[model samples]
Target: MKRNVRLVVARLRQRLTAAGNPGLFQALRDGAAEGRSTGRHRRVD
Candidate 1:
């Protein structure tokens, strides 16, 4: 399951790069960082 998540993130990174949307990609990174710092985990489902 963890591996699958990693794969999805990797694919997203690639697509974001290919699309030339650094700002959006950085936002995602920042959001993830914020979640980690706040010790909060959001469920997708």
Candidate 2:
């Protein structure tokens, strides 16, 4: 199950890179961090 999840995530990342949005994930992570600082309890993963 964990392997499958990793494969899916890898594929999605490849697709995102192909589409020229490689920094998309990083931006989202940064946004999540900012939200956390504001006391948001949302889980990105």
Highest TM-score model number: 1
Highest-scoring model, lDDT: 1
Q: In model 1, which runs have C-alpha deviations exceeding 4 angstroms? A: 40-45
lDDT of 1 by residue, 1-45 (tens): 778988898899999999998778777877787778887554232
User: Listing every candidate in turn, what is its Cα RMSD in Å to the true structure after a full C-alpha superposition?
Assistant: 4.7, 5.4
lDDT of 1: 0.78
The CA lDDT of each predicted structure is: 0.78, 0.73
Candidate 2 C-alpha lDDT tens digits along 8-43: 768877888899998996665576577779876455
